[model samples]
Target: MTAPRSGSILTTYRRHKELLLLLLPSMVLLVLFNYVPMVGLVLAFKDYMASLGMVRSPWVGLENFQRLFASEDFPRALRNTATISLLRLTFGFVAPIVLALMLNEVRVSWFKRGVQTLTYLPYFLSWVILGGMFLMLLGSEGPVNWLVQAAGHSPVSFLSNGAWFIVTIILTGIWQSAGYGAVIYLAALAGIDPNLYEAAAIDGAGRWKQTRHVTLPCLAPTIVVLLILSLSNILNAGFDQIYNMFNPMVYDVGDIIDTYVLRRMVYQDFGLATAAGLFKSVIGLLLVVSANGAARRLSGGEHGIW
Candidate 1:
């Protein structure tokens, strides 16, 4: 039996040699970029000295983590991460789903394609560029402020003001990502059987009824899967966007875990920064597991990471 299985495996490998060869580069890249860097995670528990190198670094156990949690900036960063993540999850998550549904209903192919192109164009632009564009647009003497002054009101600093800054981040995130994110839902929608809609129509269902009973039910599994996956990003509040858009003035409401770690690294606290990163990773893993479990239970084993 073992000899037969080995021969079978060899046969399969030989048959798919070309495909395996094609995948070799990606496999190598995955190991080099993703798996290899995991070794540096140990720096979180060590008093890392660049001169001593990773292997010779003194092991300090949880001291780095303790210092990270005890830092004055920790609470503010945590609060900002949680608030912004939640806001994005609430609004940003739904925007794509709605856009996908709307696009799916469009009868004109050219118009729908044009709409998709325009909406998703922002997603392809780097936040570094978009950040500067947004800043200029929202600047005190920029077009928006100029229009505000024309209307006889004070020029509000959208990027500098804490509350407005948070709202801006969420709205801009939705605008940037909604169209691209909707692509997944659109794929899911395409996989849905047209016969289901026909059946519903034959049963006296109108457009709204068909949508409620057919379209949504078919999309539920995909929605749940994406929602469970999103839980893992609870601590990640888009470093590029926040880092570029925010100044010290809005740190109270805009500083997130990534930005905090970047700040620590800038100050040469490598150990503390590593500890904070590890902390975020650990929390994110726990959240993914918990959310997966909840999704499995709520969905009667129909949805989960597993």
Candidate 2:
């Protein structure tokens, strides 16, 4: 029995050899870029002396983490990061679903394709360029401010105010990412059986009924997967966007874990920066795991993210 099972495994592996060969380069890059750098996570627990080097660095237990816990900026930064993340998660989770549903309803092929192109275009723009454009449009003296003045309101300094910083981050995230993320939902929507819609319509169900019953139910699996993935990324508040858009005046509301680490690194506190990074990574791992577990329970033996 064991011999036959082993032979069967070998046969399946051999049959998929070409596919595995195709995946080799990506796996190699993943190991090199993603896995290999994990070794540096140990720096979090060490006193990284400039002259001592990494290997020669003295182990400092949890001193780095202790300092981080006691830092003046830690509490406020954590709150801001969590608030921004939650906002993005709420909006980000719904935008793609709505876009996918709307796209599916568009019967005109050309119009649908044009909308897709327009939506996806922003995803390709560099953060620096997009940030500058957004700043110009939302600046104190920009076109938006002009409109606000015309609307009988005072001009708002979007980039300078801590109160508006988090809102700006969430809005920019939606602008930048909603389209690219919608592609997966669009594909999922496509795979849904149109015959189900036809059947529902034949049975006297209107468009709303069809969408509520057939469309949403069919798309539930994809939605669950996407939600899990999004939740797992609670810590990842888009470093590139936040880093490029943030100013000193907005740091109280805009500084996230990633930006904080980068700041510490630039200031030459390698050990503390590494500790903060490690803290974020550990929380991120727990979140993903918990999300996967919740998915399994909710889906009840259907395909899970794990």
Candidate 3:
């Protein structure tokens, strides 16, 4: 039985040799860049030393994890990461879906395209550029503050205030990615069967009723899959955006695990940094698996990443 199974596998591969060849580079790259580096995860369990190297470094068992939990910054970073990610999941996640729905209702082609183009343009811009642009635009003496002062208000320290900084992060994050997300939802919307909408309309349903009954039901699987993916990244609080936008004033509210790990790396605390990373990976894996299981159970084994 094993010999027959092995032969069948080879036969299938031979039949799809061209397609597999096309996929070879990506598979190789994934192994090299992703799987290969996983070997370094062992550093999390060791007291890494420059002189002794990764293999020869003394084993520390759970000491690195213990120190990570004991650190003042780690707790703060963990809280901030969860807070920001949840905010993004709630508001930022919904924004794109809303935008896609609105766009789908637009009758004018040029106007809809223009809106999409303008909205998604920011996603292409690097955070370094956007961060600098935002810093200038939101500064005390900038145009935004100018308008605030003109309206009989004091200049708001958007970047310097912790609460305001969090608001800024959420708003800017939404602005940057909403268009791209909307495009994804729009593609999913296109795949929905037109007959479902027509059937609902034939039942004397209004546009809202049709959307609620037909459109939303059809979009459920896509929504479920995207929601599961979002939940899996509950620990990721947009490191690039936060790193570029954050300062000491907002550190209490904005600092996250990625940035915390970066600081550890800068200080050459390899074991602790690796431990933090391993912890995040473990949490993410558990979240994704749990989310997938819940989705399958709720959807009667029809929906989810699997």
Best by lDDT: 3
> What are the clashing pairs of model 2?
none
Residues forming the 10-long window of minimal summed lDDT in candidate 1? 1-10
Query: If the candidates were sorted by their lDDT against the true structure, best first, what order would they fall in?
Result: 3, 1, 2
Q: How much RMSD separates candidate 2 from the native structure?
A: 4.1
- lDDT string, candidate 2, 1-306, tens digits: 344454576797898899999999999999999997899888999999989999899999999999999997765667777888888988877987898789889999999999888888899999999998998999988998999999999998888888777778788888887788889889988888879999999999999999999999989877887788678888887889988899989888888888898989999999999999999989998998888888787778564665
Models 1 onward score TM values of 0.85, 0.87, 0.88
Q: Native-vs-model 1 lDDT?
A: 0.91
C-alpha root-mean-square deviation, each candidate: 3.7, 4.1, 3.4
Query: Which candidate leads the pack in TM-score?
Result: 3
Q: List the candidates ranked by TM-score, beginning with the highest.
A: 3, 2, 1
The predicted structure with the larger TM-score, 1 or 2, is 2
Candidate 1 lDDT, 1-306, residue by residue in tens: 344454577898998899999999999999999987788899999998989998899999999978887888977899899999989999999999999999999999999999999999999999999999999988998998999999999998899999999988999889899999999999999999999999999999998898899999999888877887796778988999999899999999998999999999998889999989888988988988888888888788977769
Which residue pairs collide, candidate 3?
Answer: none
Candidate 1 regions with alpha-carbon error over 4 angstroms: 1-36, 289-306
